[model samples]
Target: MTFSRVNAARGLTLAALLLAASGCGAKNTPADASRAEPDPLAKLQPAQDMAAYRAMSDLLYKLDQEAIQRELTETGQEKSTKPAKDKLFGFDATRAVHDRDFIASGEGKALADSLLTYQTPSGGWSKRTNMSTPRKPGQQFGTEKDYVPTFDNYATTTQFWVMANACNAHQDSRYCDSASRALSLILLAQYPNGGWPQSFPLRGKYHDDITFNDDAIANLLKVVGAAAEGDERLAFLSDGLKAQAKHSLVRALDMLVATQVEVDGEPTIWGAQHDDETLEPTSARAFEPVALATSESADLVLFLMTLKNPPENIRKAIDSANRWFEKHQIHGLRYRRGDELPALIPDDDADPLWARFYDIESDRPVFGDRDGQVYFELEKISAERRAGYGWYTERPYKALKEYRKWQQ
Candidate 1:
């Protein structure tokens, strides 16, 4: 569920292209037509607002670089302090409230109260905020100042689950009302194209992109599907609300099939994020370049596999992504988390590992640093990024395992 940043050189290229497109840069060179590689995403027509999206992405990249530079200039290096466990809060609280008895318990009531207090005016919860404590006056709903209400990191959806369960246990109008508002946020945040953004009330930059990073969109889809299917937790939803959930579910499913990344006219897996309108792969944070994201893609595949008697297109998409996983898995080495930095230890008997990002064209494992340099080897990136981010994952094995059973 970790998200990385992008390569700065690639950002410069994209910025240059934007400038050239706007007639603000020198052009008319015709010497290298033979050397230019055709764009793999050309067939997937860009959205009308693609230029704006790219411009914003470029701007964010620059701002990120500037911020990092400032920190390094002032402090000699970027600070890396891990927050205390009590300070780090997310879906774990909701996950622990599994039964009706727990929901009726005093501790559960306190948790529900804290969640209700923190629910933003827009009806969604913020990521990583300490929901164990009640909101203070004049405090932002989110833990981070810049982050608005979001579905990222199991935020709003998880709160919705907790509230719904609380409603079921106590028949409290407060819990039901809160859960309903959260559900409304889920339905409203989805783009007309049926993809969900990382954060809503449309916080521009990459936050406005159609996000799958940390399974943001995928998690929302699960909640929507559950509501549509009349899940007991959401039994309080009105028929009208349930119908809306059903329609949202249908559009999102179609979007899932349509947005699968393509290379050389063949569908591959998905990227961590996509253009909100174009549905083409796009970059997120500075180190998370536009590439085939194995971890997020595996989650999508698992979700698709859960569909009973899936249509031909859904089945095809699943099969194609599964094949992509099989084709791209790293072998003969295992990812090791070292005290100093992570390493790929040589072990022939080790299970296969998948890089978090694979180059869109070459399919080689890609690593990126806060400086925006993309490297083919993990050793090439900064030690800070190497130790901080999860650059490789074993998540795809679960998807492939499920696929084998699904085939049978």
Candidate 2:
């Protein structure tokens, strides 16, 4: 849904409040309320040691505050990364995403504390929120269910892994507690069938679908799979979290195999998104058609091959998709809608590539635009969308190369 003017106003208020709680605001709360205390986070910078961590965290929050304010007042300063129409919660302070800097400094601790404020009772956080700002005590924010957390833009999963890294480096109890809660939320948000919905405490839109767009589900697999195999950064994860993540990975693969699109009764590739209940390819945005998608499936196939001693079914699925990739490959064409004379000019040796979408029945490439119009030829799509969307990619080649090694 498009964020209306009214929602935009509401969103700014909530965004500012949450950003303050995440340690981004300029002013510090008085420790005892009556007496003034020195702000420990004044003029901080990114650091690895405890003393530097303190100052670094303060500085990080300060910068974060500036980014949030700029987003609120300026035009086109902070476009939503993974918009959910929640105005306030949907947008993030899209500034320099200094994950390493944030984690190393003392400000990182306050950042973790701020993360707790955003976490819903369900243990997950709202999707597409700025994580740098700290939450204030007794802070009241979010109109309606605007505060419910989700998995989009790698929300809960990202939080879990980052705090896990902090816990590993510093072994701080607060960070550990935060990471533990994130793990609990991760297990809670999972569907019984192993697929993860785009949002938890779902808002009942396409967000409820078992998502593959932007590599959402596959990213989850990598994190949990690493934890299962005992990645040292996340070695502190409880045995129970590891077991749950391992089992969750298995269940997710089942959905993956079940959701593979087949043309003429032969399994081929996958759709960018799928129905959570039916395991069928489903349309997401207006322009996102229900067809065999090469982008996300490329990531998924590579992930599947990472598993050791895969079941025969998975092996067959991988082989089938590779064949599909080989068959549908586009050649000798650049963006046909480019600003140049011939929108699509053929290069002598343009390497084999794939279209983002393909016709389910015809097996030919397809394109769509914000107008919800579908076109068979790239030149037929609108100029804006043709320029904006990635209709062509070499990402599939990464999977194809990995498959060669996996075969050996």
TM-score of each: 0.77, 0.70
lDDT of 1 by residue, 297-379 (tens): 99988988887567898899999999999998889998899685799889999888999999998889998889888899999
Candidate 1 TM-score over all chains jointly: 0.77
Candidate 2 TM-score, true structure as reference: 0.70
Error of 1 at 381 (Å): 0.3
lDDT of 2 by residue, 324-379 (tens): 88777777776454565225568757667788899898888888878788889888
Q: Least lDDT summed over 10 consecutive residues: which range in candidate 1?
A: 25-34
Error of 2 at 60 (Å): 31
| Global lDDT scores for all candidate models | 0.71, 0.63
Error of model 1, residue 12, in angstroms: 41
